[model samples]
Target: MFDIQEELKKLPDKPGVYIMKDANGIVIYVGKAVVLKNRVRQYFHQSANHPPKVQAMVAKISEFEYIITDSEVEALMLECNLIKKYKPKYNILLKDDKHYPYIKVTMNEEYPRILKTRRVEKDGAKYFGPYSSGFAVNDAIDTLKKLFPIKTCNRKLPNDIGKFRPCLNYHLKKCLGPCQGEVNKNEYHEMMRKICSFLSGQYDEILNDLKAQMEEAAEQLEFEKAAQIRNKISSMTQLSEKQKVLSTDGQDRDVIGFSRDATDLCIQVFFVRNGRVIGREHYIFEGEGDEEIGYSLSTFIKQFYNNVQFIPSEIVIQNEIEDSETISQWLTEKRGHKVSIRVPVRGELVRLVKMVSQNAEVSLKLFKDRLKRVDNVNEEGINQLMKLLELEQRPRRIEAYDISNTGSSEIVASMVVFIDGKPARQEYRKFKMKSVEQQNDYASMQETLYRRLSRAKKEKEENIEKPKFSDLPDLILVDGGFGHVSAAQQIADEFEYRLVIAGMAKDSRHRTKSLVYNGKEYELSAYMPLLRLITEIQDETHRVAVDYNRTLRAKRYTHSELDEIEGVGETRKKALLKHFKSLAAIKKADIAQLMEVQGINEKVAIKIYNYFRNK
Candidate 1:
C-alpha cells in the first residue's frame, strides 16, 4: 500500500502539477500548485479550511503524484494538458464539444477551394473564423464567391486541368474555368490573393483593386468583364456599410456579461474584432448561485480559453477577478502581445457591459424556461410525492439508491440523481461500499446513505462547488422494502441530514409495486403518472448498480497474466490486448505483429516477443 503521509513529507516546495488518484488508482482530480509542499500538504493537514468538494476529494485520495515545472506559467500549461488528457471527475469541463464553423482556404492545392468547415487542421490551409452561426459563415462564403470567380469544385487541378469541359458555374461566370485552362496560373493566383485579402477584412484594399480592374476592363473594350467587376465592387460596398461599428479605434476586445438563477448561471461573450462585433457565444454553468462573480469569471476565463484559438487584446467585464494579472500574463503569452483584463465602472465600456449583461439575462431566462419544460413532464409526480409523503420540500431533486452485489464480492451502491423531476445523468454517482465488506443490503444501504448525505451537508454548509452527491437531494429513495427505508432514515437522522427518505418495494415478479414511506405502503397504480415516474427511477437505479457491479467483477475476473511482465504498464497491456484481442493471439504473434499496435514501439515489441518466447 502507498503511504500518503510519507509521500507528503517528501514533497518538494516547487511549482508543479499534482495528480490525485482514488483507491482504484483512477485520477479523480488534477491541480497545479505554486508551492508544491504547501499546496499538496494542505489537502491532508488543513483540509478543514478547504472547500467541501476539495475535502471530499481529499478523503478519496489514496495517493498523489507530481511533476515539477520550471515556472508557475509552465505549471499552469501542464495542468491544462493533463486535465484534457485525463478528464478528471472534479474539474470544470467545457460542456459543449461542437466545433464552430470556419472558412477554410485550401492553400496547399494548386487551384485553391474555399469552403465552410468545422475542423481546423494543420495542413498549410488558411482558416478564418470559428463563426458562431453556420448561416453567417455560409453567407460570407457566398458573398466572396460572387466577388471573385474562384473554382468551388473537387476537380484534380494541374493533373487534369484541360481534360474535362467547363460546368454551369463557368457558363454563369461564377468560376474561372481552371479545368478548361481559360485562366493562366498567374491570373488565377492573383485572383486568389485578392480573395485572401478580402477574407482578412481588408475591405478598402479589395474595393480599390476591383475598381482598378473595372477601369482596365473598360479600356480593353470588354464591357461584359467591366460590368462584372462593377457589380462586385457595389456588392462589397453594401456589405461593408452594413457592419455596425462600435468604435473607429480598431481595438480588439471581448465584452463579458453574467446572469443566473438558483440552479444555473449563463455567461455571454461578445467577440469584437477590429471595432465591429463579429459574433457572440453563451455558455451555461450549473450550480453557481452562491459563487462570487469574480471567482466565477476566473474559472470561466481559464476553461473558456483552453480550447479557443483567438485571444483578444482586451477583455472588459463588470467585476474584477482575483488572478487577473496571472490570467492576463497567460493570455499575453498566448497572443504574443499584451492582453488587458479590465473592469470598467464608468464611461462607454460600462454601457457596453450593461448591453452584454442584458443579452445574457434574456438568454438565461429563455434557456431556463426551455429546460423547465423538459422536466415539467415529471413535475406532477414530484408534487404528488411531496404531498403524499408529507415531505418538507417539493422533491425537485430526488436521489434513488440501489445496492448490487454477487455473493458479497464486488459489492457497490449506485446513486441515481433526478434534478427538477428529470434525470441528471451527469450528477449520478456510484459507491463501492467501503465499510460493509459482506452482502448485507441494509448495512450497505446505511453506510452508503450516511456517507453520501454527510458530504452533502458539509458541502452545503461550507458553500463549496457541490459536485454530484455533494448537493443535498430533496428526497432519497432506496430500492427495498421497509427495512431499507428505516436504515437510510436512521443514517440521515444520526447525521442531521435534511432530506425526506423512502423506499421502493418490489412485487413477486421483481417489479416495482409500491412506495414504502413511514412504515406505510402506497400502491403504484399502472396508469398513474406519479407511479410511472417512481417506477422509472427505481428501474434506472437498479440497472446502474448492476452495471457497476458487473464492471468491477469483470475486472477482477480478467486478472491478466501479462501484468507480471516487466516494463508493461496498464496502457501498453491494454494496447497489446486490443491489437491481438486475446492472450492466445498475443502468444502466437511475432515481433512485427506486436509492433502493429500503436504506442508499442520496436523495443517494447521485442521485450514482449522475448517474454512470450521464453515462457
Candidate 2:
C-alpha cells in the first residue's frame, strides 16, 4: 500500500518535477518547482490557500511522485515534456496540434530545388515560413519558380548530367536544364542566392536586378526577353505588396495576445518576419476562463514553441509571465541565439499588442457563436435519438464498429468514436481479425467486441495509466441489422458491460435507413437530426473499415519475393525489378547478370542466385 504522507516527506529539497495521481494511478496534474519538498508539501497543507482548480485537483490526489533535477530550468523542460505526454487535466494546454507548412530551399543539393514540406530537419537546408496556410506556401513557391529558372527535376546533378534529355520544364523555359549542363554551376548558384533573398522578404534587391535585366534586354532590342523580365518584375512587385510592413528594424518577432470569456479563452499569434506581418494564428482553450492570464499565457508559450519548426528572436505578449526569464533562456537555446520575451509598457509595440488582443477577442466571439449553433444542432440530435431509442440518459460517448474484408482474405475491423455528437478521431481503433478465417461479418463483429471488452476489463483491473480501452462508451452502434446487434450484445453480456447496443441498418443503396434495437426496427426518417447524426456515424465507420482493408491489400500487393532476401531493401528491390523487368527474368539471371544491377553487390548477387537455384 502506498501512503501520500510518506511520499510527501521523502521529496528532496531540490529543483524538480512533481506528478499528482488519483486512486486509479492516472496522472491528474504535473508541475515543476524550485524546491520539490516545498512545492509538493504545499498541496497537502490544510491551511494553505489554493485556487478552485488546484483545490479540485488536490481533492482527487491519492498519491504523488517526484523526480529531482539539477536546476529549475531542467525541471521546466521536464515538466513541458511530461505535460505534453500526459496532457494532465490541471495544466493549461495548447490544443492546436498543427504542423505548419514551410518552404524549404534544398541548399544541400548541387542543384537546389524549392519545395513545400511540413517537417524541418537538420539537413543543411534553409527553411522559411512555418506558414499557417498551405495554399499560401504553394502560391509563393509557384511565384518563385516563375521568377527564377531553377531546376525542378530530381536528377543527381553533376553526376546525372547528359544522361537524359532535358524535360518539358526546360523546354517551357521554366527550368535552367542543369541535367543537360546548359547552365554554368556558378551562374545557377547565383540565381539560387537571389531566390533565397526573395524568400527572406528581401524584395527590393531582386526587383532592382529584374528591372536592370529588363532595361538591358530592351536596349539590345530583344522584345520577348524584355517582356518576360517585365512580367517577372510585375509578379515580384505584387508579392511584396501583399506583405504588411509593421516595423523598420527588419527584426523577426511574434506578437501574442489573448481574450477570455466566461468559459473560453483564445490566444492569437501574429507571425512577423523582416518587419512584415507574414501570418497569424489563433488557439482556443476551453474551460480556461478562471485561469490567470499570465499563467495561461506562460503555459501557452512553452507548449506552442515545443513543436514549432522555428522560434523567433523576440516574443511580445500583453502580460508579464512569471517565468519569462526561464522561458527566454529555453527559447534562446532552441533558436541558437539570443531570445527575449517582452511585455511592452509604452510605444508602438504596445499598440500592436493591443491590436492583436482585440483580434483575439473578435475571434473568440465568432468561435463561440459558431459553437453555439453546432451545440444546438447536436443537442437536438441527441434528444431526438434518446426519444427514438428510449435511452434513459443522453449518450455522450458513442462507439460504432464495422467489419471489412476481400472475400475470405484480409479481414479487418474499425472502431470509431463520437463524443457529444462530434467525431473523436484520436480515440479510433483498428483491428485485424485473428481467430476468424472466413468472410463472416457476424463472427468478425463478435471477435472485435470480445477483444475490445477484454482489453477494457484488463485496463480497469490492472489500473492502467492513460488507459485507452477502460473508458467505456455510453452507447454502442454496429453497422448492420439485427444479426450484428445480437453478436455485439452477446460479447457485451459475456463481459457484463452494460451499455445500449444498436445496429445501423442500411438500404440497398448503402444509405442509413433505420436503427435496430431490442430486436425492433426504429425508422429514422421522421427525425431528421437523428437521421443525419446516425448517417454520419454509419458512413464514418464504413469508411474507416474500408480504408483499413484497402491499406492491407495494398501492402500485400506491394510485397515481393525479393523482400525475403537479406541485404535487399526497398532500394535494392527496386533496382532488381527495374533491371530484370520481372521476377521470372530475375530468377533466370546468373550471378554475373545480377551484378549488372546497381547497388547489387557480389555477395548479395550470389545470395539471390543461390536462393533461386535452390528453389
Top model by TM-score, which number?
2
lDDT tens digits, residue span 75-157, model 1: 87788788888988766555764667778888888788899987777789887665778997888888888887899889888
**What would the per-residue lDDT of candidate 2 be over residues 1-615, giving only the tens digit for each residue?**
888888777888999999999999999899888899998899989998765567678889998888888988788899999999999878888778788898999988888899999889899999887777999899888998888888887789799999998889889989889999888888887888888888788888989888999999999999899999999899988887777788888889999999975345899999888888878899988766556788899899989998888899999999999999988998898889999999999988998899999999999989766864676766787899998888998899999999999999899999999999989999999999999999999999999999999999999999999899998999999999999999899999998878899999975546676899998998665565676678778888999999999999998999999888888998999999998889999999999999999999899999999988987
| Candidate 1 ranges with C-alpha deviation above 4 Å | 1-7, 23-25, 43-63, 106-112, 119-125, 155-160, 184-190, 202-244, 251-254, 292-295, 311-319, 322-351, 376-615
User: What lDDT score belongs to each candidate, Candidate 1 first?
Assistant: 0.80, 0.88
lDDT of 1 at 43: 81
What is the lDDT for 545 in model 1?
Answer: 98
Q: Which candidate ranks first by lDDT, i.e. highest?
A: 2
RMSD to the true structure for each prediction, in A, is 28.7, 26.5
Residue 552 in model 1: shift from native, Å?
Answer: 64
The Cα error of candidate 2 at residue 367, in Å, is: 0.9
- Write down the lDDT that model 2 would get: 0.88
